[model samples]
Target: MTTENKGAFYTGIYRNLFKENGYSEDDITAKIENTWNRMFHGDDEMRIYSEVGGDLGYMVDTGNIDVRTEGMSYGMMMAVQLDKKEVFDRLWKWTMKYMYMTEGENAGYFAWSCGLDGSKNAYGPAPDGEEYFALALLFASNRWGDGTEEPFNYSKQAKDLLHTVIHKGEKDDGYPMWNPENKLIKFVANCEFSDPSYHLPHFYELFSLWCYPEDSAFWKEAAHASREYLKIACHPETGLAPEYAHYDGTPNHIRGFGHFFSDSYRVAANIGLDYEWFRGSEWEIENANKIQAFFSDKEPEDYRRYTIAGEPFEEKSLHPTGLLATNAMASLAADGPHAKENVELFWNTPLRSGERRYYDNCLYLFALLALSGNFKIWFPKEK
Candidate 1:
């Protein structure tokens, strides 16, 4: 709990668990790069990213056969962390050309879904996509500097988007992404519910410093609010959180989302990264520990949808490989008995294959980058 200068922001040291666990640096680097290469440019069965024209690209949600802001924004974050500026720019360009809503109630937000041909499939915004898009854009600006063009003015684009996210409803033009009263992000721009995986205090911590000066304090409060909200959303003993929850932290059962499933897998990963990046909360450590413990005896092949209290359903998990990857990523914060074992299990697991490879492999690479100390915060260049 005594963080002091222990966090990466203060000390610039990201823990390389792979090396500590005796994996050679060469092996670790090869594993990361090879996985990334395959996911981006490999054969039809392996690749998720598809380049269009010369400058635009998109990450397809393979199972759904469509483009999603979730996958696209996630791809951008992955690219920026690995210094793949060209790839980052391509994804951003596609996002703007196809997903950016220019003149509607959702203006300034990206459409959450689109056809593979770059046609809009939905005009409403998903909060998770906007948050990740903003963070990835900010990182791109810091790492590569902003371009003068429309979508390329990275920092400004990020700030402007965030401003709209927080301030949209002030003039009754549209709804804000985060509930202003509680500072918790909504499931979508027009909803009152929240997604536990969407509560990324780690990103908010950085946003508070890098966003427009006038909005700095709100982001700071948001960071704190998300940290506290997680404590309520996640079960005390099991550490499982529903995919969607009410603002008061109870499960929101609308559309059958009030259970632990694919989206809930991210809570553990998010808690791990938040602790590593900022050392923000002791409770995060406990939560990570609890999560790893709960999964310690469970195998990916047998994974299932579950109640937050840990009751399992007969329905198998759609993204079990992704679940293992995230639980392993939880080791970044968890120092419990299961931490090393979870990491070892994840290390030996191969990238998922077949029609559902997109989501699983995305989480897989994220965990790999995180555990290998490759995923990092890109601080802005000094003037």
Candidate 2:
């Protein structure tokens, strides 16, 4: 599946999957812009992003009523990709002012959660947020030249953060985000297990090229390791992966994360993006097809927690919109019978409203961007 002339990283030609499938370019552009406005500037219940005073801003986890590193980092990525530099800088400022951990084992990492008033809710960091933050900052550095100020020095901030992520435990001060031996990212800094959704080989591909020279080899190997890890983590027939799994890809069963649920939805999206960007693995195409086929006839309203083996549970999905969005995103890699149908269904589905809209809308926007050929790698300019 490694096509020298097809993948965006190789050819700089991103496929607009929507246009290929008959969605009008005007409608797609309007949808993307309207969604962005609604999510960032809409009324209280609709907007997740909030500007604090003059400079700082944050994304609220509406259901939890807290500011999470996940949302903040995601908002940054969303901003940078859309060329909304003001929004991106505000989110980064708020992250540094409130979430940055300065004097602990988790130093150099952002605290995973905080109150709307900027009080820490959790001191520990989530590797998902850290990885996203590093990539977003690097993209910012490339798209808009870095400033001379502290956090505004985007490239340096990203490189420094990545250094801590890969080298934190060298002197026993803290644990690194990734397992040194296996090269797979952990669910959290101190955890032994991995979240299948956290294994973003596309991001790692860029990290390998853009990170400090000394750490480049580690990231290159990590990209390969994550691709192989997904092959083991995802079910062969259904393509459902557990939210959390052991290093060998077995369901970890801790706190009942062994089953497919909310966090598990991102696996499909990640696979689609990795294939779209690098085309490093042919298995991605097969896996995406399997995922779409599994949900092709199922109603999002009837979405439920399921075993990776494809058995349903009594509980309904909390973020059904997110589930649909990710499945649609899989269309980027999938070329099977279900791919086009999935994308069409997603285009007709309305944005989720109310308490849990934060996560669902975030995934919704990302799907729209990818299918529209908007979510892209911002390579540094040649001197």
Candidate 3:
């Protein structure tokens, strides 16, 4: 019921971690803006977005030399939360123009990867992208009036996308993004397992209210399913979760993603945001405590792949700065003794400065927006 009547609106009371750690408000805001400008418009080493033909742009995964649904949708989510419609539209345009598939069993789904030149690298859609795209489009429709155009019809696009996500295979070629029986999103349209980091309860809670009436119940069940699903996917003592897991919560090793690594970093950030948005459960508080405790003593540069049970592997983290940012984001809901320590660590860490800066900077900026309360849902003025 929290999502009805425009849903459970954001309170805009973000945790002032910087101020708590002796920073001025102006300083924090300036830092955030500076980071945003640098990430979007700075030199090659600093920026991630590339404007293609006049109206379209793509957020490239600089290190991967390709565009991914992950980065494109993430960029849109960031744009909407920051009230940057231009950036949001550009990314969405490029996605629809190039990555969207219009034929065969995958019609209406986005190809997960594409070359920088706008050619498809794969045909399979990644569910993470669809989830983010739906939520961001809904926010866009509410914030900026839906324009009279194809992709610009924001709410319609959102609703249609959600409809496809749930009913894709009802009488056709494609598969639904979620498992009808379990109500949990799949790692891919055809996969039986899931990525722990893809479970975003906060997003699902809102979807329950905004989605088509016939499927409203499905989204509500999805919210409950993701919350309980995370409880088991994450380790009780360390709060570590596998990058991929079975529906029953055990780590899935089919592709060697069972260890906590790059993708696993989002679990903490998701829990933090879910708690901030809904204040729905006590499990989040405990989960936050356990994860922060698990990494309280490890140096950021030393981050590595680890088993959900807390055993570290020899593999180094591809996105250490990102991992640190999400850990700091976790401080939003964690009332534990080590929470401040984690926030301070994140404050001291600068935006990543190398080839892999794309993903790292994206997560870094989100943490900044979230912790400062700038990442928010916008509403249209009542007529």
The backbone clash count of each candidate, in order, is: 0, 0, 1
Candidate 3 residue runs with Cα over 4 Å from true position: 1-12
Least accurate stretch of 10 residues (summed lDDT) in model 2? 1-10
Residue-level lDDT of model 2, residues 1-383, one tens digit each, is: 34554689988888888898898999999999999999999988789999999998999999999999999999999999999999999999999999999987999999999999999999999999999999999999999989999899999999999889989989868899999999999999998889999999999989988999999999999999999999999999999999999999999899999999999999999998988888868899999999999997799999999999999999999999999999999998998999988889889998888999999999999999998999999999888
Off by over 4 Å in 2: 1-5
Q: Clashing residue pairs, candidate 2?
A: none
Clash list (residue pairs), candidate 3: 3-7
User: Could you tell which candidate, 2 or 3, scores higher by TM-score?
Assistant: 2
* Candidate 2 positional error at 29, Å: 0.7
lDDT per model, in order?
Answer: 0.93, 0.93, 0.88
lDDT of 2 at 20: 85
Sorted on lDDT, highest at the top, how do the candidates line up? Answer: 2, 1, 3
